[model samples]
Target: MNVPADDITGAPAELSVAEVRTAFQAWLHAKASELGEFRNLSTDVDEIFKSLSRLQRLLYSEGWIRLGWPEEVGGLGGPLVLRAVISEELAAAGYPPPFSFGTQEVLGPAVARFATPELAAEVLPRLLRGDETWCQGFSEPGAGSDLAALRLRAVDDGDTWRLSGEKIWTSWAQYADRCVILARTGSLESAHKGITAMLLDMDTPGIEVRPLRSMNGDDEFCSLYFEDVVVPKSRTLGEAGEGWAVAMFVLSCERGAAAWQRQAWMRWRLGSLAADASDLPPHTAGEALELIHILRLMSRRTVRSLSAGEQVGAVSSFDKLMMSTAEKFLFDTVLSAIPETLLLTDNESARDWRSDYFYSRASSIYGGAAEIQRNIIAERVLGMPKD
Candidate 1:
């Protein structure tokens, strides 16, 4: 699709980060007339998610979302850093990313890296174009952080695998069109070594999704049940016993690549916080900005490593820890600095602040817990003896 004449002057695949940002800002300004209805998306999760999906289609049509992906997967093909810039610019321009942005960063790269070429070619574009949504099924009722302990059994039936088990805390699974699921293929003694990963169509029989409403009153997470959900061998992400490696890869992206987007959005949120509570003491916003900058530095390194073809590995745990810290600190300041607005006001702005502040409490628990990250750092990064 052709970019609006006023916003693009060159091929998307060749544009530098700075060039893309400048051009994209112009496009956003020009498209303001079209995007007016999508503003203030965060106030309502359902409306925001729907609007963001439409926003994804808008970005894909302009070729902005295609820059960092491979041409074979229906992308323009450029440095991974380009993808970071696109998300940053969107958040900077006052648009919350489509939910797909988070899933795309967390799962898209892993699929591109491990899925068969035909499978990647067929599904990746659907995700990119916002024609469908997907969820990760790594966490089970019994397995939250200890992903290897998951018991979602995927028994091999010669030509196809039958998945039977439950997954919990899968965000937005109820609306997903597909899922990236991890299941056991070997005996319990094998742990992670005996597991396998597959890309399963969510519409398959015996698959069910029931969204879990969080304290924020939004059904943003779900519990997924699979009862002999049949998946073809061609849908396997990698070799049957190599799911541990795939899980590792997906986790790294979730913490690192996604953090870049998170930081950019956090920076915007800080700006909003500052503006809304300008009457507060200087130290409040000062500390908040400082913490966010530290996170930006950590996440920037992760992004650069990813662009340079380097695996972030355990380092992303550190990023996640810092990310949660920044998020919690930022919102804590919001509640403290503007108590009346957050606790007393009745407008949409106040409602948004209240909701976000509550959600920030989970920053430490989601995307692997802060406690887990500490363990990883102490053992894996610091080479300390595990207790």
Candidate 2:
């Protein structure tokens, strides 16, 4: 229902989450015609990025995007829950998420907390307004799940740091304006302790980005090579030997807020799945709904914790686990109910289904693999034995 309130001016400083949602919903309703063309999904990545950037700029100008961020970083100052609502409401309205959502959720908060004031003030606003995009550079050739084993090295160079290493599985690096990188500054023996996180501009010399294609056949991820890349000391997110903490924080958001957004998109996809798959069995649909509902509930709690400024920590593993299983289950249902359309048809919709199906298979692998999440749950959350 609409709030019956005046147009939202993006300065609802004291509004509660429900109030914010009401006003935002009303605004969306009022601006329906203006945002109509943005309602559809784009097949091209460049198109998607460009369209999302435009959307971000619109939201920023309308003040809607600034509701939950600090004024120092181009926001109007409100609870972070307001930010989460913006994502949920957009997805509920059939808009694919802004490409900035993942990076903003995963990396923005870390920089806000850890970067120097000057850096945060300069970079966060660009990120929020979609003026720039950022990527997380955590995993290396040998480090994915076990991030402590990462070997990307950063050497101190007085005013700057000289970085030399490779980072793989970096999402959207080709389009990123900057990267939140974790590199080792001490001996390998120090492992996680010797690492530090840096906020580096993507255009820096000696940095190469090579996009890689997965089974979905999209180059959504890339390999980043750093050859003596010079990074200002001011770009450091946290002190030396503190990247593990920074990494943990980013992962928390990845599994928490990103999962929250994923569930929203998945809910929309579930509805679309039902509409497309008339032959989909009732039990299968019921099962899928229930799984998605569980993810929504788990993610909601994590979001609340985050909005309240609580560190969600390892509890995010539960959400990640649920998210992966639920994704695979949903797409598996698509494949089963529409095998010919999903596998043999040549239309755009068919190709989309095929791509989604393959991408869903990797859901358990990214954001901490299924096996590793189980270990975290068993030993960390459940307090069970390590083995």
User: Each candidate's lDDT (Cα)?
Assistant: 0.87, 0.89
TM-score of each: 0.95, 0.96
C-alpha lDDT of candidate 1 relative to the true structure: 0.87
Cα lDDT, model 1, residue 239:
94
Model 2 pairs whose backbones collide: none
| Clash statistics: count for each candidate | 0, 0
State the lDDT of candidate 1 residue by residue for 1-387, as single tens digits: 334434442466666677777777778888897997776665666777788889999889888888888889988887889889889888887788788889999999999999999999999999999989999989987688787899999998999999999999998888889999999999878998999999999899998889998987778889998899999999999999899999989988988989888888889988888788768678878888888898888888998998888978888998999999999998888888899999999898898888888899989988799999999999998999998
RMSD of 1: 2.3
Candidate 2: worst-modelled 10 consecutive residues by lDDT: 1-10
Q: What stretches of model 2 exceed 4 Å from their correct place?
A: 1-7
Model 1 quality (TM-score): 0.95
* Residue 34 local lDDT, model 2: 87
